[model samples]
Target: MSSIKVECVVKAHNEIGEGPVWEEKDATLLYVDIYGPSISRWNSLTKETERMSTETYVGCVVPRSSGGYVIGEGTRFAAVDWEKRSITTITHVDTEKSNTRFNDGKVDPAGRFFAGTMAVEVRPTELERKQGSLYALQPDHSVVKHLDQVDLSNGLDWSPDHHIFYYIDSLKYMVEAFDYDLQTGGISNRRMVYRLKEDEGIPDGMCIDAEGKLWVACYNGGRVICIDPQTGTRLQTVQLPVAKITSCCFGGKNYSDLYITSATKGMDEEALAKQPEAGSIFKVTGLGVKGIPSYSFSG
Candidate 1:
């Protein structure tokens, strides 16, 4: 095992901090507070954070090749004008239902945006299962439903070669791989790559490293685990300061540092007291690995 070092860079008490995209040119990290309904940019060097309310629970945010950002705003794919603090709805999806909302999303190597929905209401041990679906926003601003009957779409990433797509349906307790087509932005040949035991926690957001291993954040497990997708074996473990570690991505100038996000959602006073950094942003350094850059939406 390699020596891992962790630090708390920003004390953002977000309700449900989820999607994190690192912009190299600006030397900043952009992430969404799913329930804060906001998008935030944190400077890596200065540690300064700027947040803008999306007005609706934002599932994720990614830099748009056309400028600004493309956000999963509730049930819609919208364009976010950072400078104007304005949002323009590009299209609405899942218009037939209100029980689900957009959850996690990412851009493909071809510059297509993909996001999935999850049950809107959560009970102690149950949620409206299979009320969600996965969507793709093409470069032309058209919406397409690629997968349906999804319980909780969380993590989604592709292999370094862009041939295998990895995905997580939180309720399923496993990581799934699919044969991917870079040109068509399509996936098939679904298979399980990793499965977590009951005590290991739920898999949440994910990203790939240069070596093609998976760095997965465990929501209730409080750890970011590195897994060899080919063998379904655990290669490394990064224990965070708090449980409910929601998502993670690679950043830093060299793309070696790992930035993690957490959530305080559904935690009672007692639970909250046990982990005061429940909603803070964290960083892991000296992992001795580099990560691929986050793709931007072409449109």
Candidate 2:
């Protein structure tokens, strides 16, 4: 580990900025402003941002192997062609629960999109009812339910070798590991790989580094903590200017830069005033590491 430099790269004050994915082909970062209900593409060098509006809450976005992006649009899954600015509905999820919405997600090694949902209203008793679940949208356009009884489904990623899956249900204050079969897209043997103390903040979105370490964004914790899944131990922590750290991904020319997203959703005016960078996109460099390139959805 080395001294890392964290800086705010984009100053867009997003209410809830989550789900960051790197588009390697374009050398750009694609993320969603869930509250803005918009998709954003940021060019690191030029610092210019392009936004595409969505009809409802946009939880996550990933590149499609064919073209454009496959997004979790509101209560349904859809495909967006940036060039045409057109969105085509792929499928709808949890239609019976009008209050539930898609939150954080990522494409698995097998090209399946794994996204989870959370309730819009964060009441403690309501959350205790566990109004969330994790779903895997296959390359064939089929959706499969993996886990149920989730409170706040959040961070998700896989081990570098594709044999292990890592997920976060934020309200649980822990990260779960699953035995993943890439060939069949099956997950089993759910176990807690890491647990956070209440004071450490809840685990939100995460990504895996090349060395097989899980880098998790700590919501309301003001940092991203790197944990070694094998031993369930903390490795390093990268401090940020904001407390509502939502998500992160590795991008840039060399794939060593970590791009982080934050939120300003639950802060008071006094708290927001003190942390002006609460909703900005942050970048952490100087860590001697690299990350596996994010896979695009093949469907």
Candidate 3:
């Protein structure tokens, strides 16, 4: 197969575009504009875009089996009813810290919603530095803090076999793996899977293709790289016009099209001039890798 060629599929005027999830049922791409505090939907067939306003900065969004979406706002988890245009706060996270907010998150194969938190505004104390945590929310609305003491929790995914979980702390520029027990929600045997060199950009979001290869977004590298999870071998790289590529996922009817999200919030004038399409969504076809379908919240 040829190296993927990425092209802008949608030109979004978002200040920060982060999460991109493709809904197979509706043939639409759903993503959040974190700074915009809005959920945007794009119809791949009709090329129409729709926006829904929210009360907080939305970090990520996933489909719910019951006809709505489960989303992570700054420090809260909520369910949005698209039909009624209503939002119900299901759970509030990190309320005591005041400096932390929810970041990247995804659902496991067993239907549990997992999300991580990050410092919204840095403070000068140890408590403020250790405030971020990873949470697992059960269907009954109960939430559990599974892990803590993270700087910038982002980029979460699972291996195709459901036995390995991949996570990233962007500031550390490393991707870590944990042995995952699908039946018990137990994660152990944590170890570094891939550590980015100083020359490379920080690792942001990631996704696993059908073959179980990991596709990780390079925040300041202006590219997405495919890597062998077990061997840590770089397989391929798809260049983008923006330096802050945030996340990516395989979508489209066949799941062979790769969709990428980017950010423009931190760019200086010089960087912005070089990357005019900083916050736009790009698509790469002929990748030949399909991602696992996103699991919805069962409740």
Instruction: Score each candidate by Cα lDDT.
Output: 0.91, 0.88, 0.84
What C-alpha lDDT, on a 0 to 100 scale, does residue 223 get in candidate 2?
89
lDDT per residue as tens, model 1, 1-299: 56778998889789998898899998999999988879999998787999999878899999998799999988999999999999999999999998778999999999999999987867521688888899999999898898999999989999999999999998899999999999988889999999987877989999999999999999899999999999999998899989998899999978999999999988999998899899999999989999999999998
- Candidate 2's TM-score reads 0.96
lDDT of 2 by residue, 133-247 (tens): 8898999899998987888888999998999999998877998899999998899999998999766787999999999999999988888999999999998888888898999
Q: lDDT rank, highest first?
A: 1, 2, 3
The candidate that achieves the highest TM-score relative to the unseen native structure: 1
Tens-digit per-residue lDDT, 1-299, candidate 3: 66667789888756668778899988999988887888889999998988898898788888888888999998999999988889999989887877787778888888888889988743211224566889887778788787898887889988889999999878778889999999877788989888887656889889889998999999878889998988988888888888878899889977888999988876678877887788899999878787778888776
Name the better of 1 and 2 by lDDT. 1
Any residue pairs clashing in model 2, and if so which?
A: none
Which ranges of candidate 3 are over 4 A from the true structure? 121-128
Question: What TM-score, to 2 decimals, does candidate 3 have?
Answer: 0.95
- Candidate 2, superposed: residue stretches over 4 Å from native: 122-128
